[model samples]
Target chain A: MTTDLVVVLDADGRALRGRAPKLASEQLTAIYDAMVRSRVLDEGASELGPDELSHYEPTHGREAIDVGATFALQDSDWIVPRKHQPAALLARGVLFEELANAWLGKIEDPTMGRQLPGHYSFRSANFLSTSSTAGSHLSHAVGAGIGARARGDDTVFLTFCDVQGTSSNDFHAGLNLAAVHKAPVVFVVEHAPWEASERETASATIAAKGAAYGIPGVRVDGHDVLAVYRACREAVDRARRGDGPTLVEACTWLTDGDTPAWRCEDPIKRFEQHLAHQKLWDAAIGQRHFDTATAELAEAIALARTAGDPDTESLFDDVFMNLSPQLREQRRELARTATTTTIQP
Target chain B: MTATETRPGVKVMTMIEAISDALRTEMKNDDRVVVFGEDVGPKGGVFGATAGLHEEFGETRCFDTPLSECGIVGAGVGMAVYGMRPVAEIQFLDFIYPAFDQIVSEAAKMRYRSGGEYTCPMVIRSPYGGGIRGGHYHSQSSEAYFCHTPGLKVVIPSTPADAKGLLISSIRDEDPVMFLEPKKIYRHGKGEVPLGEHTVPLGRARIARAGTDVTLLAYGAMVPVCEAAADAAAEQGRSVEVVDLRTLVPLDEQTIVESVKKTGRCVVVYEAPKTCGYGAELAAILAEKCIEYLEGPVVRVAGFDTPFPYTLEHLYMPDEKRVLAGIDKTFAW
Candidate 1:
């Protein structure tokens, strides 16, 4: 309900001139460690894939928005992510190898090499597929919430979009439908206008758009993992209680704007500083988490490389529940000549 | 779950009534079955195809949605992915363009893109084709667009019985289905439909008439026109076989090839535009599989390549005489 930007930890990772939310040491450390792990995976993934597939949009400083918001929800809740967030997937219990499989476009992945890199889906974790279409996941999240409510389940659906994504028609229709039906959906908009220089043209607040749709809007400092978690937790609780949707706009930056130091604006460093202030983290703990993340990434990449590409005949599969006679014939024809390579004379 | 069991007895119903009965029957049997779209609840849809559903199943199961076709289809895809069999209604097929991205990109590809971990078990019901005197905005037969999508099942029912049966199968299928209703024949005739639990399998064609001279391949509203043309062909001492291709994606190619191979001549009838229409796919299949058995080139009796006209709709849509002329072309050649 508060339109003001909610900040718990300042840029120095120290408490600001306000009451900060309390959390258990383990919970705080877990959130911080997950953010660290995600940053490591992001760096590793950038260079892990083969050839042209190595390119990826690294989640350099948006760890808090991914890990923190996900930390607020339960395992039964659904996470509908538009962009790839390794932190969120890790928090949802997705294995590092599964992520590597998806990044490598291997058959072991849930999408079975059908999707491009970063378009992952883990049904066991209740994580929906990452849609490439901007703002389209908003309505799907709302519909998932509505469907769960109709089935008498209290599963909340959490979805995210960026400032530019708010301009899509689905954003308008999704929020309006969620509010009208009082669906259990929490929309999290990571407003980082600094990523795109042209994004500076629009000075409007993403949270303010929720007011026109009759939903409570709250803004939080995206760098502060605790602040994002608290705001998302409240929204999740509100949705679970059938009070309707809430839009939590987490304002963040891709890097330190005023200061040249990455530690000043890095979400993982800020959360680590907070943990240090709480006397729950130190260099040894940080090094151990970093080593674990690096080792896991190495193992995942190794296993992913061992896996072969999907079968050529699988190209015709999954187009429908059962392959029709037409696709069956196509699959047979593909298998016949798919292995033959023509050599130029 | 099981093969559709049709209990004894039948009730004479129109295509619209059959559609309503299908919705009611499926919603009654499966609590997960939901019927929704703009004006589908209280208004029972613009054509009354979903009439009495709201009263029968209440708002949760049967309700109206916002007027956004994209929202209706996209949300239905979400619901279906979440384990609900959503039978979403699009007032008219011409209005489905706004949801085309959702239909092709999201719903159709949900299962494939997700590697079967997630599936979209839903049916999108929409009235299609000309003869309703509607202008271009409301009368275009756009099923060809959906038929081109690999994962989507494009089904068109000509008779009331098939409308009810195919709809039931569509609802239970573990993939998305485009149940394009022929609004032109929504109430043209009443036929004896099974009382309850009658289901027709997808990807199968029905032989409307048996013949030995020429075969008329058609679907939806054109099925009746092809049959009537067969009667007219019989007067000229030529037996014309009419094949109703129920589902266009899987496309009863077996039956189509078999019929054409027997008849040695083929005429494809459709209400969509001639260029790149569904009839083109049919003719290609006939040429690919039955060319050796053919006696002449395949003729296509379809709507013009121009936009659907309001005032000149009767002239634009192919009638029985037009189909007969197509048959005569095959015989003359």
Candidate 2:
């Protein structure tokens, strides 16, 4: 079945009379800035040539879905991002230097360069590390949501995935468990427009699949930042009010082609035009945001390049609460065979 | 004999009852403890290992889940990470294949991968090993698979007392533990158990019987088998030391190496296949740490490298006869 796309903005960036001022002017400008920054980072990251680093799929055109869904969450709420969505971390205020160092597998990364690039995690920010395996983090989100309810904390968990991820058994298992237990979770699916063949072969729309698990499903125009934000805000509110999960499918076009039409459809560009129409954006303001983001990213890249690799002796850290006798012996053997170097504490 | 007391003033129970008691005690002490699996609630578990938990803890805490092993374990990992002590059952260790990814990839690696930011403090319990005519599907010693994975604790209890104590420790541990119950002796192995708050710590091996002639290292069902073999060796005027390695992953290397060093002869016994089995690890450790102390080559008495057989179950398992033969061969060598 075909689900209608929920849109709140017209082609000319005019909102309906009642919903025009739902978001404060400052919030809208911040969302636009975040989108621009994310787009710039993605473009620069993609330009970094092969240097023994694993390349992650760029979140080039899906900035609105990333920033909107993340901005709607409270500090207590949790977000489990997919492996490719670096914007989720950027929206959560992760430092660009940390992201750069993590991508370079340097010692300064929080995970000690263990995780791949774009798979960011910050416990203090309530953002879970992305699991490389598709659909694995869905159940973890459900569990966290249930845990929140059990602790009498009205915290909601939001997870992001793609159209193909819904086909995994873990996806169904998580949704079923959440529906049965009334877990406070929101599953946001970025339904890329280029996946028409995938959608055609599927039995139903990704949103409709939520109904089978007794969850409320809503589809939105992903390019419209206000629409996506509104849908996610409603879902988060419902979850905090003891209602079960909601599956939000943000239908978006993949603007990967080097064409002007694709560039025009960019979520960042669309939001910028909308802000300009509202007199909140101009050439000076746009240039300031661009310059700040470029300078910050350049500084982060330089810092990451100077960071050294993790010490060889530190390979046995964090494997368990404490190293067992076997591990201690193994570490000793490794220390004896390796060149001695000072390890960071 | 009265069912109440096998030994005066002491309660004698089977290994299964000891496991149930451990779960009950932990659930009573800590409200975060939860138990769930297929047929574990109203049906009281397929083997009655969780017989009274449902009636006592109520449906919310002790419940049944869909027959999805992956979901059962994956949810357990999530719950543990979210600050719940979940005790998930897999019915049989043979059925744990579907949940292997969740156990190895997610649960085991949660702390390490998250750089110690998150941890999965959960316990996965399943009845394992051959005997009782369970054939291939129902009976298989799969401890080696989990022991090979880092960041996971693997435990096996041989007697009723160890079952109660070790399980309590596993539930209270701050890491994911794979508790494999020896189904072969779950009912037949009854012993006097210490009542109330008894906990045998993980990574400690117990000397069932001390001797100087040979060191017989074993765990799980093989513990009793090796004990019997020690008794047989005593009849021949050869003293045999039996060391029960209750936990495999965090192996008590000091105890194992010390025992082999003192005896100068070692025989490792397990019901799993010989090649690349947990016994191989014991042999390698012995070779690495106690090679000079050994007067003979380290021997292994284990099941054949084949699927667990149905009617030939008795022959496939490592019995007292095979263990004794291994001891004698090592002495001759």
Candidate 3:
């Protein structure tokens, strides 16, 4: 018998755990500090900065970051994060420097800074680069998993998104390929409570949709890292053992800040308070972690302010690796004639 | 004279066989090379160009794909992006549309969008053009579609030697290339193709036959048609220079304009529809840049504006008669 759907919620909607973890923590201080830093990064990042990526909207729902799903995989496993959220990458050992560098389109960043802030990729980590269009990256992750399995290596691949991003042929094609090929790919689809303006009806759950394609779908409280870690561990174990693909709906909430134009849920503040109440961390340790995050972020901001903006030469240089003879001549002409161009603050 | 045996210094084999020999040679030369497509594995291609390929290379390198064109192309994109020199076959030109998304979206944009970080130096092979009784679906000339797309190198071979030599060169190129094999001329046109090793440079147009009166710019199956047209025009006391544009996207405009300036009259020929065809593009360029050198109106010998008709396909096709007529009209002007 299979469970239709599973929901793991903590009191105060903060520490929801859908699937519990099989792995034990070696660093309580480090994990707590990392979560504190993640929360600071979230709080510090201005969601209202600018509509830089105004072209494509989240297909069916407001973008919801799956909090607990990123930490459940092994060290060698690949994670294809399909959103701007850093919760998963944070767990996967992606540094804030690298994420920010990639976001700023720096050359040293993996994927050569070809991606936007949300779509992250790492060559060394084996993370498949994300595409701007919703479903293209999903299929690629599936292909990478297949390639890994073919080599007799059992490294599981993970991609986390929701039904909002799946309102495209890309999703259907990628998932279909994974299902038909029995690739060792586990999908974490975080369903939003609302679909842009429309509240999500029962029809939008990816579990029902994924079941139609022969991929086993599991729903868990996305808020609880332990619950997500536990479920994902099982899926990863099953995948490593050649059980084929799995789809997980980690039921999460958007808690940053809710607005008329968009919705947000403050997941971090609530979770930390729960940890304190349960004596998971002493009040002093928790306060210091938050204070350390604040100081480090302040230093990053100061360094960014002093580092200065990149010049216009980057525009032409970044376009090609080796410029053609004609393009070389054209660049010489641009140097001789075109006026200096600068970026505004 | 037998086509396969060299006439003292020349050997002639079918175009498809030359392609097979080239692929075979290239694979042996490089260890990282792989070939794939629908029906291209153990059974070879539908045209037998990849015949005996799987037997020699094993199914790992040379393999058949599921009937999904998009998957075939997308998988090639992935593999190429992963640093393998992959040669993906689209089976037929008409069916290559399903992979156009992969071509234009992922393959073409990878280098540019990555700011030169990642590139897919992959080659897509498909049999294109009409002359055989393939009618609308299979026989349609689709080179113009790829020609209009930027960041893609498009190559078409008119002879057996070129078919093999160019395929080898395209595989080694550091850019995405659409290698269109004229299906009608695959076995129909035979010539001596160097067997040992050879490479043809891309973005260069060859003056197939040179003369003075008019310049005939053409490619693919139409190279033969233009040769016949030039021969027919020569009988009328009019000499013609034929320029075979092997690669169309990054066109050899300099070569074309130079040939046109010398001839003082020009005619462009292709098998695709007359409107928005490669011929029209050439016409516009000549009119704008080489207008003073042209002694006559640039005439076009191409397929009709309508969809390729089934029964009237032969008539709709730009044949020797139509090409000759077009040349004659341009000479008169």
- Best prediction by lDDT: 1
lDDT on C-alpha atoms for all candidate structures: 0.85, 0.84, 0.69
- The interface root-mean-square deviation of each model, in the order shown, is 1.0, 1.4, 3.7
Candidate 2, lDDT over the whole model: 0.84
Residue range B190-284, candidate 1, lDDT tens digits: 88889779999998999999999999989999999988888888998998899999889778888989999999999999999999999898888
Q: Using DockQ as the measure, which candidate wins?
A: 1
What is the fnat of candidate 2? Answer: 0.54
lDDT of 3 by residue, B122-164 (tens): 8999998777888788888878787776567789989888888
User: For residues B1-333, could you state the per-residue lDDT of candidate 2 as single tens digits?
Assistant: 212475654678888888888898998999888898899998889989888889988876787877778778877887888789989999999999988888998899888777778889999999999887999999999899999999999999999999999999999999999999989898885788877789999999999999999999999989988999999999999999999999998999999899999999999999998899999999999998889999999999999999999999999999989998999888897
Note the DockQ of each predicted structure.
0.71, 0.63, 0.31
Candidates sorted on DockQ, descending? 1, 2, 3
Model 2 spans > 4 angstroms off? A1-3, A16-21, A193-201, A253-264, A343-345, B1-10
TM-score of each: 0.95, 0.93, 0.82
Candidate of highest TM-score: 1
lDDT: worst 10-residue window of model 3 chain B: B1-10
